[model samples]
Target: MSEAADQHANAHTFIGAIDQGTTSSRFLIFNSLGEVVVTHQLEFKQIYPQSGWHEHDPNDLVNSVTTCIDGAIEAFERQGHSAKDIKAVGITNQRETTLVWDVRTGEPLYNAIVWTDMRSAELVRNLKKRLGASEINQLCGLPLSTYPSGAKLLWLLENVPKVKEAYEQGNLAFGTVDTWLVYKLNGGARANVFVTDPSNASRTLFMNISSLTYDEQLLDFLRIDRKKIHLPEIVQSSHATAYGSLAVSKLRGTPITGCLGDQSAALVGQKGFTPGLAKNTYGTGCFLLYNCGPKPVISKHGLLTTVAFDFGPGKRMYALEGSIAVAGSSVKFLVDNLGFIKSSSAISALAETVEDNGGVCFVTAFSGLFAPYWVDDARGTIFGITAYTQRGHIARATLEATCFQTKAILDAMEKDSGHKLTELRVDGGMCNSDLTMQIQSDLIGIPVNRPAMRETTALGAAIAAGLAVGVWDSFDDVKNVNTEGSTIFKPLVHEKESAVQFARWEKAVQMSKGWLA
Candidate 1:
């Protein structure tokens, strides 16, 4: 493959991509042209104590990244490729989630406030009521709901004395997962590049949509003392003078080149370089992002304006994102929590065993809802369950969770962009389930295209770095080395079937509303 021109395809240089996601950490090696030569993945812990709260040990994230790096080098050696050939590294991570850590000791001051955590639900509602929804929506390209990081950060400062004290003493540094990884990967507070990009920073609720930088007004509104806290310097997502080098690895001196929130990275990996190009990633959660060129579109519906990634010296590209808080997480709920399924792969078989949901619909508001409806009080409400319902029916409904959520988000994006998407480019762990893909296609009444490698997140980061370093010039040059996998799911069910299913889901949504009261 000529992903990049052959001039840069010689054996001396390769790119390493570290894709740190919500549930796992992975290291992938890409050749000069833009191909995944080797990859290693490790899943981490997800802690759920009280309802609407989620947590992750920051050390686990560090360990997982290190392990994947080492394991991937070993895999590369087995494949007869030299890990030393690596010239740079690209990092893609889950965004909006906040991490507050000690600037001196390098230890996380608190468990990471995961993006899915809804502890700030009340604060969000209060803020929305205080600041009109129309103003909040138009200004931030988002709704005044619980899904943002600003309210979560405020809750921590008021409640966690340790974090507040650290902030008061000017020893606190806050960041999303990307900043956390770059810190730990390069030696934490001692020897790391503690910086983030517009792509990730835009979601923090601190950044101004127009300036693409943190705003003074929002800071005042949040009452954050700039002198007491450390905010990572925002930079281009594709360059950072290389994040030092990785120790205890074969790919030492490999410049860390790219950084994007996972969803935006997926858009890059899917080659969504133009307007109207969109991708839906079905991971622990499902996220739909539509590229809206360089200009950001504030949403009338519940959508977030985000930077896809600033390529280089050019203006940062903007996108409208609709996030589904629970997609594959529903499957995890079934297998790991409910004990209804033994393995994740079994979910597809279980879902296929039933022709339909059999009057069952699981809202998975287990935490709350996201996208079009930011209902935080809503809890998981599985309705229309009849005596004949079995695991198969529940399994089908679980798969439907992704389909229904995707449909809602697509509608929101459509309203925001004033353009109807022709088809959806799908990737992530859940897209492997053919049944889910079919359901997604039927619900949208369009074709769903799945890439061959399915590791678009990692690949996206790689492309970002590759482009920045001239490993590839222009998006078209990457096509040669780009290897695409295909599995297109076309709508099979009738239009009325889709309408019927949507109505049932809407009722469940209504029943689950006003949960906080």
Candidate 2:
């Protein structure tokens, strides 16, 4: 339109967020008011090389992100906005997906070991037998689990020849997916913006929880040479320069100022800034993150301690996190494998055909149980099925599996935090299911709150970038965002019925354990 109109649009620029999740990659453009103006998404491959081993092609992850960004920016331009109107970029990625590459060549030594991979279980078990294994939680806020990157890193160093060679030659560079994306987006070795935020770093079991820096003790415990393997410099979650500028995008040279783990980003997007505020994200996996305040609390229960986010220097917050390995993936299984539903959304309609699970309980342990149980031996199991069972009953049981696991995690979080959550802020693909949300609320006995703009994962990254570039004066400036159109699902089932359902689910879980053993 007019030159003045263009100038005004450029002055009030939008922020971009690259949300690299477990099953898909997305790019979103958000206005200063925390509303998404344009977006694009691309689902990538979920490689299962062998049983219990999950991997991703590093190039596929990078290409998916760049493609999504270009697609989103094209949509933004179609809406009459200039590419230059985008000010800064933020990134939120699936945490603990480990990667190692060459520093000079910028080529990955191995496929990224996904967070769900259980191949490192043996390594973790052996490590636990060593002295001072219990003290690792005090150092890194996490116990020995295959879910963290450290075990995967160790596996790469020991099994992969290229990685081991690079490690010995001091050419190895280690980072989670966020660090890898930032380095690649900034022109790989040319810009070398190799840095990670506290939220992602905390999942590596390397960062000291209190100081927010790498601990030498942890490095030694894992037998990693600090000088040989290059670790990404830890930076603020919302920083101006550490993330560097985008070198390959429609908005090339745009500064990437914000970074967080996917779950932590959802917490930020949901405005869970205050202590005791908690949010559960239902993506390929389900993650329940409880804001525990400034200090970290090592869970005496099964939950892990992690960084919620570090907005700026001295603004770090910690969280008690309970992770479920299967959530939306269960619906995908129903659609793709069983052919019970045509699309992911159809699961709700299919479940509606049945009033209840009809005495069936599906423990969706496709990748095994996580959180308090830590049953890596467990496999997917459906209990109490009979000749009378229908597809609708199976669909209802699949949804109930997610709800039951969420209730168990929330119970653990309540015990660890000494405060019960009044409500759960939710977002992601599965939260669209009214049946699932209602079941979640009833199983947990708390209101399940959903926002009008449910793409909070991308919104969180946008908020981080926007904050870093001064788009919003403070978190307060965007406090009222997504607040108007919200829905709350309260418990409808009686407490006794809920208890009976959970007990049956627990029995199924117990029956599924030790399958791999």
Candidate 3:
């Protein structure tokens, strides 16, 4: 190739983002301008063995990811870009989902436990009673809840026969979905890249957020022996040599240079690089992450302290995270389960048919309440229902449920961070709804900033990979790349009205408590 042709090829070089979310896996290819060239996604099975028990077949997760990567690359090549032009792949995964595999065979011992799985509720309660919540929280920046990986892993070790045997024989390897994907992508046992970044590791309840490494005492408190159960090595979120090479797909041999938990990746993708800048991702669930700078701030309120991202050795950032168990999933429930709408996108129009919730308040604790409440016993509840209630009211209430939960989390975050958040940067599937974004803004009493690029989660992974591979020289180069145009939703409701609505939401939440007890 001539010099000009080589330079043109280099200019067309892309970065790949592997977004392994709760319900689906997506691969997105981005150019230097932060524009997505092509993408592919695949939804997989969500196995519910029992009430509040959620499991994902480990193979399904791996297959969905690999397929998306191949499909996306095919599209990229059809656009006249070389597959080799893709520099590096970054991973952003649903956090706290636990998986165990064999050291020799590279096979999962049991179905991957999803983050929303509450089968670990009893285990969590027991640990809270035995060790108390403060000691663990002080060390690991997490409360004893079903949301953490430690509780899910404990449930597996005690209940699953094969997993227990693996542990006893010292052949078990434990990892969150991110680590599992990395391991499988790098040819598993052949060239196992068994590693996790600080963002994913912090959700395990074994990592000290300040030190950004696994805490031995915290592991001991959870009865997890580091020697018996193999844990992935803690690595930087964006490192030159950490995540390892992709040994499969059209982009085989591409280095995987960046990793972040899904919500943390969204935060980074939103360019929430400054402290106190908060972003809420409205995905299968809603996650509000507030950048808390370098030091970890233990939440006095019921928020989680987690690693936001660690770009390199000393570039680690901590965050206050609020997890809502149901958000877009509530919309999916209305469409798929209740037939309230034809599709998830039609929810906004269905909801718009009703001027308000018509006195109804929905507490969508599908699994349980997370962040600031920590109520594992709370089930989904709809209150203030009367004979005059209509489907539109129910639909409005369903969407409002997410907005109310966002408000609750914002209140808790303010209490924990000692400052009111001026605005919230938002992305994901549900952010496409103007009504929902307006409701979020009105309820939170702040502006909701939605980027022109809705795929910030994938963009976040791409940014990390691009940074590691020198696609962009520094943060400044990419800071304003895709941020030129944005839609901002300002609060339209009066403070008193929002407060009254929030009070009703709180009452519904309180009523929803102990339903599963």
In order, the Cα lDDT scores of the candidates are: 0.82, 0.90, 0.90
RMSD, one per candidate, in order: 2.3, 2.6, 2.3
- Predicted structure 3, TM vs. truth: 0.97
lDDT of model 2 at position 290: 96
Q: After superposition, how far is residue 208 of candidate 1 from its true place, in Å?
A: 0.8
Better of 1 and 2 by TM-score: 2
Candidate 1 global lDDT? 0.82
lDDT of 3 by residue, 1-517 (tens): 9978855664587899999998999999988777889999999999998988899999999999999999998888788878888889999999999999998889999999999999988888788888445598888888889998888889888888999999989999999999999999999988878999999999999898788778888888887888898999998889877888988888888999899999999988998877989999999999999999889999998999999988875567899999899999999999889988899999999889888999988899989899889998999988989998999999999989988988888998998889999989999889999999999999988899999988888888888888898997777877876787899999999999999999989988898999774
* Model 1 worst lDDT run, 10 consecutive residues: 3-12
Rank by lDDT, descending?
2, 3, 1
Off by over 4 Å in 1: 1-13, 131-134, 240-242, 247-250, 480-483
Q: lDDT, candidate 3, residue 122?
A: 81
Native-to-model Cα distance after best TM-score fit, residue 383 in candidate 2, in Å: 0.3
